[model samples]
Target: MPIGILTTDTGKLVEIRETITLNSDAFSNSFHEDLQFHFNNERIPERVVHAKGGGAFGYFEVTHDVSKFTKADVLNGVGKKTEVFVRFSSATEQLGGNDAARDIKGLSVKFYTKEGNWDLLCLSTPVFFFKDPIHFPSFFHAMKRNPKTNLIDFSMRWDFVTKQPESLNGFLYLLSDYGIPNGYRKMDAFAIHTFEINNKHGDKYFVRFNFRTEQGEEALTSAEARAQDPDYYNKDLYNAIEKKNYPIWKLEMDVMTLNDIKRVDYDPFDVTRLWKKGTYTTVPIGCLVLNKNPDNFFRTVELSAGNPGNLVPGIPGPLDNLFRSRRMMYRQTQVHRLKVNHNRIRINEPLYWKVYNRDGRPPVRENMKDAPNYYPNSYNGPVPYIDPARPKERFTIYERNAVDLEPAAYFYNHYLCDEGQRQRLVNNTAQSLVPVSPYLQQRALRLLSLTDPQLGIRVAECLEEALETPTPAPHAIKIPRHPYEGNKHYVHL
Candidate 1:
């Protein structure tokens, strides 16, 4: 029996089988039952974060030459196009939660460059909750509901920010209308992390990706978002593609030079801050248009794997602690949940294929028998290596003291230069943390004082004066999710 497909000039490409018709396959519950029963015995682990989502197919076309800034080929070719798939989801919500709800949506993009895959794991907002990756678990604990009670606790979120005063920049964006996006297509996506690009000459500059939506920026009011359908984002994407109003965004980048990094008051590698490290701001790079929707949601949208480790030539990795943590965590989680063949799924293996990484469960054998399974085997095996003429790798980071990632190795003080910035940080803290226990609140304020005095005093005065702070708007209710909350569901097959 042969698989059937509708090809050019053929009415229908069908294989005539003596025992069964293709139509009969529709009633094949037993086949499904056997697999699903096995699946039930197993489990589908939810992403510890970014639980629910929708994705689409598109191409990211280079619209400008950024060769002077970075060696990334995708940024060099003015008219070059790289295939892309983007998935949007609320970071804290479960799979069936409201899409337009007040929450940070994970804006993840995968660029299938000629060299390899490049994954940008970003939040809709440019800044994040915390800068130092060492405080990662603390940030999650703050966002999540109290362990004792399943309900949300503002005290948790406030506690963490209160301790980490530097988080004000990111928290302000969240409290503002920018927190809730109307839909995936209406939001400005980001390559939030600071990356470095090396040219063939071995010169390097910091890089950040900015994706401005062509449909225009839009956000729903908290009330409006709450009342909308749970699948609002998913519906908007699907319907737009159906109507041919294909969504698009231009890929822009802020390339900061080495001198730029030295001058900025903030560390560009800090995921928690968003400031131009260089004299030059975002340079026009390319445009990405999502024109095709997924054929199967589970295989593509839900199971898609993304990691910063997949980079092509000209594009080099930044030694950010968060990025390094993700490389190990993401690769481990994907293997643990979806198996080693997750990339072999049609949704992920659109054009690029790695031949040597064969002989796994769910293997599609994309290249067939001609391709060797082992590299440098007796037969002609896959011997692809780093292109020497492309971007050369940058400075190597010694891992001797980077293992525990001690606080001394991470914390920075340059972002506290401004009195207004300090005041705003303190004021925001005092206002947000007043409701918590006085002991904890005072402890937090004391910690803020460690970083900056004005910060500590203002927060104390603000909290003292906030005797009757008004209740947050009904829709202002927030529930944060931890990094590990959704991972328990995954069971190894």
Candidate 2:
């Protein structure tokens, strides 16, 4: 067989000598086209959050019969397997940031089910930083770099944490050893929002999804994580898959009936708080096994989009304000970044879909061919399927203005049971707080004290010990004093 000639993006053959310019003219179309093509579209917009991630192809097999709880085909029959693509990411890290950094890990699984694509966007922790979606921007902004200095400022982080006391429970988890997981394979994932699922009888149940790692939970200490490779998590996942040591997670659900929701003392839909233990029964639904690695990172991983709004029958989208906001925000962000036809992308496309949405972006494919794009048409446009099992009742949620500290208090006292775990939490919290300003540190300490006095005391003692040793500043850049520091005639400017 003979080798084919190199061609431009337009498929025009190129001459051997056309690759270089003639004399000093540099007017070759082939050379310019190649250079322009490479230069013009070499990069795509980075994700605003969860920019750094690794993805793998897998299958979720239903190991237990969950048909009694819901009518979802994905969780119905035992031994049923559904193709899945799982992406693990760092919530706050940029594209090239360290995977082992002490940050929230994002675990989103796109299940290519028989009906359509169902995305379960999850986080490493069972609780989130804040409840209301209004604080979403501020929470992420504080977690990210400072605007002026363009650095991770501890004062900025602590300031937000102190002001929003509801964030204490989340911060407690983040400041614990669990914050730095050994790798993505060893960590659990939780759908923090409480979703409502219905049975064939239209019986509704409020449930929380948890994917517990079958590999057993493991974590890296602050020192151990700092010494590992920056892409340790990605490398670990890829290598494990390549070696055929597939990682697996058992899918479980904590279910509460409508009556149980009314009997609960705390808000069931609160993302910042966890349901009290024993209040709901945990049911093992299935197991997810990652058996294959993505062939191309950019195509299979980078371009993949997961939204909480993607749901099949049985499971209805959560009505929580944060979840509702995310349902709109995720799709819009993907549209702005990956275009409106992002779902048309190979990795994100559903196993079966027939929507009336047509045209607007490049990968519109057939654009639903000649079918009508509008509903209620005589030409037989795609119509919504009404599931008889779907719940129709509307429930009222009472709004509360009070700040609850019991969750954090429960986490600190009950969850962090052992002395070693408690000490590690104190050390981790102190390590981050040491760089914060004195006032902000005091405020943080006050917040922690409200959760548990011993937690506050231990952290303060660690800070005191750290201050006694007086380490050098993180950066050596010195600011120039103002020219009119002591001048009485200086203007207000």
Candidate 3:
């Protein structure tokens, strides 16, 4: 490589790069352009969710071969390793918000493999707030701040949640002790949706990934979290790595055959519910270790973006509505936030790649010189791989419909075995719902009653007590607007 000292954006030699002195007429063109270029593009849009995040550089090492499950080259054999970048975030919080806040955690990983980049997008909780993509905006608006007051409103939050009974399970999980994890290293992660994977024999299977932290799971109560430092998680991670203590997570997966899904009682692909834990076996895939801290936070951590669409050859496109909707939304937001060539950014870019995509804003590399831009040309170009091992997806025809609170109720009544845990769930639910109106409170009680009778009765009693002596809060004094009221902009108000 030639030794060249130049500006990062334009690759021009450094000449007259300094600003003009007070007595001079004007600054050099390079100086002015570099300043303007940097000033104009200093920041990109933060993620609508997962706004606050920290990341590290590491490698994912294959511990057990999964060749029978998928033909993805990264997981083909034991001892195989690939470079990875993992970003951990707290969803529903601003960039400056506290890390130990009681919220869902985002676990996004990018594997730079021999074939291409593969992103494993996941969350700390196994289930989500709702199943349908249409409820996405409503759910976030409810969880987020009230527009007029710029404060969290329990009335708005409980109203939408109570109406969508499917969200009750996830809501209960968030209100539990597991909600406020001690730190990123102590939390478990799950791929919240079903993914399609194929083997070299063209055999396909529905799969869900689970990453349990080897550090052992730990969490803090609401009072404990409030007493600790806000950025405790971020600082703990950085300090752990600096002290040569790397955090690790083992990758386990649940595999279901085509016939297995048919026999299951619930929808296997529902994001709001999980596959019964004992019904399927969890195969050990690999282990991920985060060992290096980022040198530049903005360059590596802030600009990094991952999507469900960035899949390898072995893992074909997902067919679930939630997965499909996320692919489209991720692309739209990435393009809007970081331009069409967002992947070309340093941390997100693939280690080795070739493509016909060229000539866009921030064209950093050689624009495939003297090569035909279109396909079917005489010159060599990237061609589509019609793989011999491509699996034929099994299609089912049926009217997709939503169910009531049966699944959420089942989990609460059966899965939660501890008496103390049950009591905590009831207390958390009551404390949060106490500020809302009686109508919404009763609605929540009805939904919870369907799940577990005692849960509903207990919450009802708490509400009755709370109603006799209501808490003094600003939001409780007035009626709340519609959940989507603040979404639209007023041009001539």
Candidate 4:
């Protein structure tokens, strides 16, 4: 039989040209060596976060038949086989860290549906920290180790938290038993956003997704979490699969009508709060079974890509600012981490990728060989996914009219819904700062005051009772060198 090799010269499929070679020739070794050298340099880039993750091959079968809710083809067909790559991650920091750390878990899945790579992004908790987009940089800085100290400072972390008490709700979940789960198998996943479901008729409904584990949620205590090895969660997951105790999660979605949104007391679009489940029932979607594991870790796990941007036909997502940010950021990261061919990577590749994007990093299938690289080409390149039956679904975008951009906006600020978010931040932050120098405590007090006056007073009074001596350089330390800045400008300092 002749060797079957790809022929890219033709617009149509063709076999490789046959060549004759002497098997005994020593020059053949030289040819093989040169080819191996090029092959060795073929590895791709890695993702910054969600870097360490595990995935499996599975199908997202729609049991609810939400076609009336969305034009998304994936959710329309019952028992449809949409090739999916689901990533489970640690939300607090990088993927290199242990699975059982005190952080929110991330659940991102790429569904290779007929519409496109429909990405479903969510978190372990329903709410998030901070609402104003401005705090993102500051919050991320506090989460990381101090540049000079190279250590995770509890003081630094709490310092930012106490200052932005709005993050209290998310922190509540972070500090709870749920924060450090045993493994991916036992953690719950939440979409954490109010999205829209658009049908062929263009009718829209507010929706949220929840993935509850069939195995039940079990978390480790703080002491036990710290005592065990960092890979405890990873090991637990791998072992469970190895033992054939295959784990599954029931996919549930809470949906509300436009009428419900208008009637609700608070903003459902808030990332920090969950729509009351009783107010809106979760219709069963389908089961997510993690049966197969990857053979190669880094290629499949580390460099894999996921974003909330990838949406399918019937499942239309909400139009939230954070959700939009995730979509663009994730795409940009994919370009850097996995190269322009990030989407083409085995793990990120869609089962039936019918689109205009072609030619990047690695060229599989003649790199759409000889086809018109650009759209409107005469050659048979991929075409975009559009319903032959109807128009696309769109949601209303609010650019801030009445609502204050705090509290309900993020995980930390929970005053809008859950009872304990703000108070926890106040107490936890006050206690942490209570032991610090008086000068630092006062600065901290002022920051908390910015959130709410009562919060600041409570924190300051708590510090006063714990009364550490004022540092000798109190005035000098508080005052900065050079010209005074804007709002924080206090020449008095």
Highest TM-score against the true fold, candidate: 2
| Candidate with the larger lDDT of 1 and 2 | 2
Worst 10 residues of 4 by lDDT: 11-20
List the pairs of residues colliding in candidate 3. none
lDDT of 2 by residue, 251-306 (tens): 99999998999998889888889999979999999999999998889998899999
Candidate 1 C-alpha lDDT tens digits along 1-493:
7475523222433233412435666344344444456777654888777788899888888887777766766667788888888888888777667787657888778887765678877778876766456776677666755889965677787666665666655665664456677898899877677777777677787778788888988877555776888988999999999899999888787777777777775455766655643356768887888889888788788878887777767677777776778787788888887888877766666365557765677865554567766657887765666656454445543322211111211222343444554444445455557668877777766665664565567668888778566766676766889888987786789
> Model 2: residues >4 Å from true position, as ranges?
1-5, 21-25, 472-493
For every model shown, what is its TM-score relative to the native structure? 0.74, 0.93, 0.87, 0.74
lDDT of each: 0.70, 0.90, 0.83, 0.67
Best model per lDDT = 2
Model 1 regions lying over 4 Å from their true place = 1-43, 263-265, 276-278, 364-375, 390-393, 396-435, 438-493
- Tens digits of per-residue lDDT for model 3, 1-493: 9566655356765555345444554444666667777899887787888899899999999999889889999988899989999999998888888998889998999999988899998888888887678888889888878989988888887888778777877888888877888999999999887888899999888889889999998988888998988789899888999998999999988999877877887777788887886567779999999999999999888889898789999888567776778889999998888888888888888988777878887634677776778876777887776899986657652425675576677666776678877777777788898778878878888878878788899888876776688556665566789988989876995
Model 1 accuracy (lDDT, Cα): 0.70
The Cα error of candidate 1 at residue 95, in Å, is 1.4
Candidates, ranked, lDDT? 2, 3, 1, 4
Clashes of each: 3, 0, 0, 19
Q: Evaluate residue 144 in candidate 4 and report its C-alpha lDDT on the 0 to 100 scale.
A: 63
> How far off is residue 407 in model 2, in Å?
1.2
lDDT of 4 at 56: 62
